[model samples]
Target: VEAPNQTIAIEQSQSDRSKKTFHPVKVDLPGDQITKVTLGRLHFSETTANNMRKKGKPNPDQRYFMLVVGLYAVSQDQFYLLSANVSEKIIVRASNPGQFENDSDVLWQRGHVPETIVYHGRVGINTDAPDEALVVCGNAKVMGRVMHPSDSRAKQNIREVDTNEQLRRITQMRLVEYDYKPEFASVMGIKNTHETGIIAQEVKEFLPQAVREVGDVACNDGEKIENFLMVDKDQIFMENVGAVKQLCKLTNNLEVRIEELEQWNRKLARLKRMSSLKSTVSEESKVSRCSRATSLLPSKKSVPLKSNKVKLCSVKIFRVTIIALIAIMALCALTISTLCLLSVHDRHFEKHPIYRQVVELVTSSSVALSPSTTTAALQGESTISQSTQPVSRIPEVNFCDILPCDKVYCCPIHLQKVKFLNYEKTNAKEKRSRCHCINCNFIMLLSKISEIIKKKTLFLIFLGIDTTISSIQILETQQSIDSRYCSKNLQCRSGNYTYVIPINKYTPMDVEISLEINTTEPLIIFLCKVTFGNYCSPYSSSQNSRKDFLETTQGRQHIWTLPVAKLYDSAYYFRVAVPGFASCSTDPYFAGIFFTDHYFYFYRQCN
Candidate 1:
């Protein structure tokens, strides 16, 4: 009969008793399609049945089960099903599972649908046996950051890196560009594109900490594991940082050293400039002295002597008597002049207290004459000469005529060795006369003063005067004395053979020749006045040139104020030659000529 709403009916059904079966009662529902049957007294509640009926469609929060045969128990308001077993496997499959179905092995599956998976044990993806908590055999694309433990507590034996060592090792590492192999690319799921990185093998040689060996698990089979080298990019980056720091320190040190060298170069330039100025001043002074000496000599054409002749031949006896009387008066006058000059020379040297003091100072210390002593000596000698002879007669004495033309005469007080540039040509009588001349003595004093100035440069500095400042003051002082004073310097290099430098017509006639030589060998310097041609040799006779020999035992700088005669011609030449059998040095020696424009002759005779 059909079941409609909820009406139920019970009827007794007859069964055959021939097979030992008995008749059973049957209950049937007529209205509702749901059927409920119970073997013993029914204990099912209406509320629990109604709840099960409401959940009949589908609910993820609750579990639903269909059993063919099971024991059910109801205690208080709870419903429980006692022991149930399935005949085969049990699987819960998705509604539209694709390529996967319920099987004896898989317990659950969600197919292509995205869902959350939570597991307490290890999980391996694309790998059958995972060695870690989570293992991915191929490349993984992560949308979030992948973090590793980096706390200080996790590390041990931390220390600072040596930047210098790191820099050296980094220089040794070789960087390379290469493409991944097909097999490697396929296993790693990466494209076979060119990549830039340091070679792991090369880096291991210098910086092993930056390199490591890693297994190529994707390419390896289960039987054997294959390994390859890998370089850690982070380690290289750290090394580069340390290297940069070391380079900065080295650059700073180089900058400081460069600055120090620049300062020294500037100082040397200043000193060179000062030396040039001093040489110029000295040359000018020499030129002036020669010019004054030339001007002081009286020209033979300027003054003419007139003679008157008497007719004494007509009366020989009368003329003879008058001539005898004149001759006798002339002899008496000559004897008186001789005695006066001899007494003056002795009195000047012996009686003067200042002269005595100067003699003592020179003999004791061997120091050259000072400027003050030179001035006093000149003034005292001029006074004595004026007292003994008339002013007009003093000028006629011809001071330059008596001076030794071949030698530099120094004062006899110190008795220093006399250096003769040429053979002496003056007679003994002339030498005696020169010693007696006031002008000759003054010239000797001036020469000594020039020597003192040259050798006592350090002494001037010790007295709180720098050489440059003292030189400038001397220039100013001399300029005040004579405005015509000027100077020039001629520089050249000398070798084993002779080197010549020409002096132009514009050069001063009284120019002083100061030679400075830098060499290790002996050298001879000559000042020659060309008489006829443009050429003048250092080996020329004393009539044309004056020469001085300089011998040196060591490599040193030598300066000499050459004792040259007064320049008679408008043009001259300077000749330098290395003396002796020594070969020329690889390096050329330096030679410089300083021409000073000042009247040294007039300064001695007048001042």
Candidate 2:
């Protein structure tokens, strides 16, 4: 609010209108009737009880009183004695003015106060102010809205708050019901009943600016400053605005997701309806074509033997045509179904950002599911210590065209309600066996191991040196020796050998390891020093001389087997040392590990 400027008027002296011999005299009230004062100004003597000149003039020793309008209560010896007439104008000027207590409330011209006016006692407008309060200034304009720049687009350096982050902060805030203590309650006149609101102390933790420190008051010896805190309700509410925005954003996202789901559902229903319609149309068309062809056929009764042959030929042709039409219709239906499923699947996956990662996981699982008979993947306690080469042409069976090859591979892992394919169990006394199918290397799970172990199924651990893997040593546990299968009786070459042949261990107990020998020599293979520990160097010769050794000899041996009690926990390694010598070159061929189970199932691929 800007204050308007005005010129200060100078009043002329009225002593010129008086007689030349006349001196300024003190005006007496009631007895002498003074009709008018020249220049509309009055002065009072120094001795009067109420003197306007004495109050307005700076000097106290003035002989004659200087004049001014006097608007004040006087010594009330007479009730209505003082009266004066002004011809031109009357001006009342003061540094400070007293309150006006009258019948009529004085209204200022042009809605502005000429000078400062102080009022005592409670003054009320639309609102009340404390006693002795001056004029009240409020931010609200006459239109009842706070004043501010109207344009929002003109703002500079604007930054929008992260509504999600603000929502988290709001969740961290605490709301409590509290009551002021005795002294404070008495002062506030809100003593007993509890007030529910956010505490300033608690709110300060998350929203520091919302709770301001007004300043500390000095206490005791003036050394200690006590905290004086206040909560800005407006600031707290402003922070809450962020939470509202966050909720709105969340609601919108949820709405979009729901809409997408609805669209997906609708598309699926439409595809199903189309499939039904196509099938129905194909059946009707086939029936109609068959009927029409039969009507066109010649009657056998009206023809000879040659004509009968021609009729048969015509009937066969018509039947074939109907069949061909049916086939074409079926093919069309299948194509439409495939195209529709793919389109819907792509659209669905596109909306989900994590579909790429899902695809990767699916692809890896599909690679593991490829058919393998020569390589076995161990599940459960057993694992593939040695990696395998990636198999070419992973067989992909799409139960649903909407899913990729990996989806079929990962179906077992993700679907908990489905059981794995059951494998037939073999007798423990069986000499030796190998799974010759893809089902052995792919569809197995850990649950099968426990059932197999309970059945006393002797699992065969076979090792063979092939072109793919140069050396194979079947380990009872994950920690198996890195060595080729060598005979103790007939030795070829001496070197530090280490190999990791995958096995499926169901329990923590040792598994019986037996080998199927293919060589023509009387071979004896022995575990020079069977140890079970990790971090052992594969080339370390320290265990070669150890006395604790297990030797398996076969008089023209076909199966050199180890006891089931010898195998330890998960990871264990053993050494195979050949002490004898065989100078003759013999093809040391050993097959892969073969376990006797009811069904062939693999946990993981060799790779």
For all candidates, what are the clash counts?
A: 27, 20
Per-residue lDDT of model 2, residues 489-588, tens digit only: 1111222222222322222122245433332322334332233321112332243223433354332233434332222111222222121321112112
> Each prediction's Cα lDDT score?
0.39, 0.37
TM per candidate comes to: 0.29, 0.26
Taking all chains together, the TM-score of candidate 2 against the true structure is 0.26
CA lDDT for candidate 1: 0.39
Q: Write the per-residue lDDT of candidate 1 for residues 1-607, one digit (tens) a residue.
A: 0112332122222243122222232446569587786543211111111112244542223221111244456678675786554322112232121312223222333334588443445667776666558867566789999676789999999998789997898788777899976655555556645788777778888888777765545553333335667678888888999999999989998886677557546656676677888889867855665455446555444323111111222244366569878997676566556546654754444443333432333223234233233323322333322332222222211223323334222112232232212222335885576555545544554564465476543232222211010011112112121112110111111111111122222222233444444432223333322222211223322334323433332212334443222321112232333332112231111122111111121112122
lDDT of 2 at 337: 60
Q: Which candidate is the best by lDDT?
A: 1
Stretches of candidate 1 exceeding 4 Å from the true structure: 1-156, 217-225, 279-607
Best by TM-score: 1
Alpha carbon deviation, residue 42, candidate 1 (Å): 30
Shift of residue 446 alpha carbon in model 1, Å: 23
